[model samples]
Target chain A: MTAKISIRGVTKDFSVRDHDEPFTALHDIHLDVRTGEFLTLVGPSGCGKSTLLDLLAGLTAPTHGEILLDGVPIEGPGLDRGIVFQQYALFPWRTALANVEFGLEAKDTKKRERRERARHFLDLVGLSGFAERYPHELSGGMRQRVAIARSLAFDPDVLLMDEPFAALDAQTRETLQEELLRIWEKTQKTVVFITHGIDEAVYLGQRVAVMTSRPGRIKHVLDVEFEAREGDLRADARFGDYRHVVWTLLRDEVAAARQEAPVG
Target chain B: MHLLKGLRRVAAITLLAVVWEVLPRTGVVDRTFLPPLSEVLTALANLAATGELLDHTQASLGRSLAGFGLAIALAIPLGLLIGWYRPLADFLNPLLELFRNTATLALLPVFVLLLGLGETSKIAIILYAAAWPILLNTIAGVRGVDPLLIKSARSLGLPAHRLFQKVILPASVPTIFTGIRLAGAYSMLVLVAAEMVGAKAGLGYLINYAQFNFRVHDMYAGIITISVLGLLFNVLLASLERRFSTWRATS
Candidate 1:
């Protein structure tokens, strides 16, 4: 498969304020995301999952090695990649449609085209009737939908999401996960979704990458294969098997993460 | 519901007006010193008829508007720059703190001496008083914009100028307007005090002149006019703020 995003021995480090030694966030991380693939990255908190996503989004440069998009080395944030954060991060001053149009505006899209494309993306996210509503006016679930729409409106080649549904209630989270899958199917954009939820990783990703804690690295990558993805799939025995596999892989890493940073 | 809220808002003022009318008439208060509300209204009407009310009102508004306008034009941009650039803020913060702490009214003698007891001194005082709130608020608004919003905008490949213009500027508006609204009230307060010291034509001068001649009704009328003008300006500013920041859940 042609690589949509190729992570090559990528490592990241942060200098500590008081300490002489620099803290390693990610170490020798290597993964190849296939074009038009739904890849979920799962790891415990402090495992540098978000830092990896930030690296892919070109928000922060890697301390060593490099990341590539198609055949080109990633330099910095560009309109070619769209990112959705866990927090809705919708501009409160802008309406739902206007918020979606933000990236398009940056691209210098014509005013009428921006409006139409914004409305279309808003509709795709099932917020067709709420184009005029501000972020504060919308419910948490709806606001996240607007955030997704905003990221997708600019027609980016890759959609990088950083636990975009984690803040939502259980019911909203599940519903959005399903909707995101549907949107990914329609858009055919290479999606790198980060989540801590085992079920979420299993349900969304065609390939799930598990990471180890403290100087994070890819521990394992398991392919999720299911006959049907509708309704009773979560109740199927195969679903339990996949969830079990992911949990067993994550359990030790989660424990190590807890020891690395004990709660006060 | 709306009508009830409107009536409730006016209830205290209505009760006070009734007390003013009855206290002097019933001899509970000295009539010469504290005239009835009707006498004050009558005096206001006489002032209107002779065009004295219009002249005084125009003069007060002109000075207040000039100083307020200049403050907004200068302070908002200065605030934005100071707020966004850390080095500039650090460089000027102590100087700002010093001047902001000094009372506008306390410098009345200095203003009179430096600018002379003319419109320049009065307007300058109003400008000095109004600028601080706007400048401080603009800085705060800029500094207080959610970092997440900036990150999101940056991920979209927005240039620095566009990021500041689109994300930072709009996000800071509600706070900046908060400053402007405060400055509006400050301008009114400083304008009255400045006018009382020197102005030949404002509502403050009119009140001072009336009090000296023992025209108590005229003095009360001037006080009432100032209150009414202040209330109207407050309403205008609130509506303007609402217009700019429509996304905020109305409190």
Candidate 2:
């Protein structure tokens, strides 16, 4: 089957301050995201998983090579793709419903239709009654939920998420993960999720791509199969095996990445 | 509940009035400079009866408002552009700082020299005074907007104009209101000073004329009128700020 997003041999280099050598974030990265697949890119800090995700989102062009969505070269940000940033970057001026309807308005949908769709997605995210609440008025989890509804409301073919739930508490993360899974299943939108958590990678993704340290490249790919996994599916032995395998693949890279760069 | 406070204020004012009336008779102070409050009130009533006070009030109000209106029209848009556009800001920053640092009233002589001792000079001075606060505040407001909001709007495929309308404009509104509100006070100040420099009418001129002629009570009346006008302006702008501002508890 043809891939939904074709990532060619992409290399990203950033010029740092003064006369220092350019930082090689990602070098010669090749990945083929299958249609309607839930692909997770997992690695430690400085692995360029987020950088690669940015390239896919068309936020920045690859210094070398190119990214293609549905056989067409990715030019820049578009409605055909949706992104949920890690920071829960919801516009504070807009209410939850208006925030969700933002992209719909950008798409030039009529007023009544945009409101209807926004209401539907807010309900899907369990924030139906929070339509009038502003971003500052909502809790952290609710803000992220509004953001997710915002992304999904426009009906993008592929969803690019960069550690969307990394900022949430453990309990909220788990609940949102299950909710995300339900949304993914219901919508059947191709998802390219980036995270450092091996457990999270194993639990949510159909396949997890492990990456090397700085100047990251795909180190390994593991096809995960736990059919129709419920929210409490982590108790299974097979799920534990997948988690262990992912951890083992990432352990050395995490250590090497830590040694190379001290995190904040 | 609030009536007691109002009554207290009235009582304090009455006490001052009684002291002014009795103090002159008691020979505690010279009555020429310290004219009785009743005399000032009677002078004010006489001015009103002859419609001279109305004319002076209208003249002062017109000059102040014209300057204020011009400042509002010019400063806000210029501030928005300079704040939003780095290139424009870079070009204007040095010149703007130079103008902003110079005292507004000190240039009244320069304004009179160029525009003559007409309303133009007074209005020019008022505009000069009003511009700085509104413009600076607007720049600060727009510049301080969360960069993430712009990024979010861009990612949503909001075009440049739409982004300005939906995000930048609303986000900077509270700050802009702060600048404009402060400008009301600035307008009063500059207008009075400019009028004092050279004018036949306006509250400032009335005070100046009365002082030179030794009509001390009429001078007091002029001072009181200027204060009242300034207070009214502040109240107006404060209410407008409250109505237009979208400040929220969320941020």
DockQ of each: 0.62, 0.53
Best of the candidates, DockQ: 1
Report the number of the highest-TM-score candidate: 1
For A100-176, candidate 1 gives per-residue lDDT tens digits of 99999999999999999999999999999999988888989999999999999999989999999999999999899
Model 1's CAPRI class is medium
For model 1, which pairs clash? Answer: none
**Per-residue alpha-carbon lDDT of model 1 for B1-251, expressed as tens digits?**
99999998799889999999999999999999999999999999999999999999999999999999999999999999999999999999999999988877899899999999999999899998999999999999999998999999998889999999999999999989988998898898888888898678999999998999999999999999998888888889988988888886731
User: What docking class should model 2 receive?
Assistant: medium
For candidate 1, what is the lDDT?
0.93
Q: List the residue pairs that clash in candidate 2.
A: none
Report, for every candidate in turn, its global Cα lDDT versus the true structure.
Answer: 0.93, 0.89
